[model samples]
Target: MSANPQWDISKALMVARFFHLLCGARDACVTPFLTLYLRQMGLIAPWVGILMGTKHLIATTWAPICSFLAKNYQKRQLLLIGSLLGSAAAGLLLTLISPLDKALVYRFCNGSSSLMLPINTTLEKELAPNHSAGIKNFTIRTKRSQVNSRVMMGKGNPQRSMFETTDSSLPLLHVGSELKTPGTLVNLSLAERTRAQDRSLALSLGEHWLFLLSMMAVMFWELLSAPLGPAAADSLYEYLDFVDATDCYRRLWVWKLLGMSIGVCSVPVLVVQLDCFLAEDTPRAAVHFYGYTAFSILALPVCFAIPIPNFKRREPGHKAIKALSLIGNDCLLFLLAVTVFLTGATVANIENFLFWQMQDQGSSELSMGLSVTLSLVGEILLHPFKAKILKNLSSLGTLGLGLGCLSGQLLYYSLLWNWWAIFPAQIFGAISNGALWWAVDALVEDLVIPGTERSLSVMLRGLFYGNGASLGSFIGGFVVLHYSLAVLYKTHCVVLSLWLVLFIAIQSKLPQHRKINYSKLLAVDTADASDSEEGAERDWLIKAMRDEHLTGRAKNKY
Candidate 1:
């Protein structure tokens, strides 16, 4: 894709909005429904679990690699566009994977027992001419069983005793005495049964193979596009610099929420309708696939129109070392890490258990999904005010408020008596998840070592959303198994309350400082950077080491 020649902020922002929305819609088209699609395709629970986990693992593994590539290269837009198109192409290939219909096209394709009904078999000499009709009925039953094999859940009858009639009631001459005389008729039927079973087994294996290959290819393409959200943030920052506009990086992500809300909220209803009309019991995943393909293709053009202004990038290793030093030196990083970890854990529990709790309170999945719309709207509402919040409370202060609000929400959940009660509680998402997100991003932006923007962004994204969520989910699974939602939520509320107090106590004890000059971190030369960011970092490092030494940890390392 070619970059647009006209690239004003107003024009670029519109393009950026469309790109983000399309990205969100594309994601909604496939990801959330993929497990259900697999189930409908006759995959069992264990296989579904493995496939979904594999997709997550791929995202976790490739995210950092993609970030590195984005950081090291120019023409990031080109990489972005390629990934978009590649994923679309991969999705389009799914149209070729519709369920296989016939099995016996092996003995004449070489061929069910009778339906095991009470119908009596007769000797060839005594049988009526209409015996062929009975055989035809058996063939119909066998084909119906084949249909069930592709049906959702796809459960089949358990094996029956040999006395049961097989559905392969064809070639009527030796129907009854064939067992006694094993002639050409019996051999043909037996061979047909064998071939049919083999064909069914082969088809099953092929579908599984196709699923594995399709998932891998799609995930591989997505790996290249993983840096998009972070890159968008970096681009926004650069644009702010270019236009001499005030930086409000925290608010920018509201667009993401808006787009995602539109996608996640609306698509499921359409998908339900599609599933109902397209196949009686089977889901129509082809729509999801082709829909994803279309959205990605649509976004490809938007990428060209969106401007991603580049700075004179710093040395890669130099930026990396800068990040390392910041981590080692800044106490704020520790606080940020622990907070985001807990935030991720809290989010995980909510995602995994909130709906379960709601269902127990008589909520439908429909209500559960619609409730998310309210939560997202709250988050978006809060995002724009982050600048004011940060101004009033500072990063740690804003974070403290977030923790307090989160605990409050948990308390409300503990007391929830009805499904509808969650609506009010979830509206507090603005203060809890949204505020915490903004606070964390604000601090990260403030602490960012200039040219390390994309690198740092991607790294922390993986930390909070990936590592923290993984650990949270692992722990939450056990917690939920033993405890009721009320008990679990109340316990979490207590824990968060303690955490908030500890956070405040530490914030008071730690050496606090004013915000660093943003421009200094962006310096192209080391000497220019050394004057401000380096000096501040040195002072902060000394304070941290002294503090750690007093605590008898890392005493000799410095």
Candidate 2:
């Protein structure tokens, strides 16, 4: 146990916080604009689709590189160097457009930056601890188990929720029966599952790396910039030891490397190709491009101000807040899953709907870019309100508001035909995204110990995001290929509605810790205690050594 209970923010944390902020800003700048950039470069839609697919492939393996780097370099230094390298590459790419230059920059920024994913994961995991000694390790292990269990169950059912079917025993028998009864219908064994998983991961590696680099830079900047309260560090050291440096680094690397697989499989391809909706060199096209970037940039700082309860550090006034937050977390995750699914499908089908809208409006590529830019502008406009909403409402309330707005946006999209009408939806998207992201970060940070494990929490977040995005993208592609865009959009509306209902239903059951004096318990106040303990221990050791020396002299004289 640490002699002092309070946590002090370290230099590494400062480095990480700044990096995360940069990542968020970068994501806002890049992701929504990449497809249009591809169009600018004269790539056709099919190649664009291939590039979109490849982004996820790179994202999925991002963590392994972090792990490998951690083995040889200081984590903080590596992050700094990575960012510098990526930034330089991005700048160079803006000026230089040859295939070779694009490839090099893309590999440096997008390909290698995946390494940071695991580092972030480890940081989040290290942050969630209390005063109890060894509590963090135990909690991390438990959290891992729970996450694995949920994933396994999710994989097994594929059609049902884990909560719906409490029976875990039936899947094995069902699998076994399938194996016995059929040739083509046979269930896969563990070996086959591993093989399939490997193949899926392997398939993502070959897409255009440059575009992925842009998106990766943007997202990572967002993550790096979000603020870290003192509670994060205090809680982390309470449970984890950094002394066994190799083990510490290794543990941090494990999930992130694995998490990259999640990213490679997650990006929504249709979203990347949204530029096809307009002809080249028009105001609307520029609007689309700028609007997306603007929204992302505005969303990050606003999200930092949103106040979700830190359930990990118990507060005094909000006794029931913890319980409410737990229910809220579950609800939020459910909604988020649905949101990802629907959004992905909509993005995939957007080209279908926009093709007509573009024809009707005679929208050019510049117009299309402008439309994207306008959406981003609208999103930017709404970012400021996020802090206020979070502070005044319960965490769940804030989430509900965001989701409600998001639902309205979807409905608006469904009812309207004008490309200009998308402004309202984009504005709402900014708020929705800010609030939703803050809610998730707060929820996870609350659940875990704060210090060293905070990174793990972040990593897990990436995992969930990567998983949802990959699956959503994959499903969206199939839906667009087979169904009309209208069908896809309407289907998304239905999923969002279902998500809301599930959140309402399941929100009462999860565990929550009321607001407590978490800061008091965390190691913030350790200045006095640590000094006193060290002084006393040093004095005692010195006296003991003196007594031993005196005894040796007396015995020799006799």
Which candidate tops lDDT?
1
The alpha-carbon deviation from the true structure for residue 171 of candidate 1, after best TM-score superposition, in angstroms, is 39
Q: Candidate 1: global Cα-lDDT?
A: 0.56
lDDT string, candidate 2, 8-37, tens digits: 334333333443344333343445445444
For 30-141, candidate 1 gives per-residue lDDT tens digits of 6555543443343333344345444445566665566456656765666666667766776555445443221110000000222211122111111112333333333444
In model 1, how large is the Cα lDDT of residue 278? Answer: 50
Error of 1 at 9 (Å): 3.2
Against the hidden reference, what TM-scores do the models get?
Answer: 0.62, 0.43
Determine which window of 10 residues in candidate 1 has minimal summed lDDT: 102-111
Q: Alpha carbon lDDT of residue 432, candidate 1?
A: 86
Clashes of 2: 117
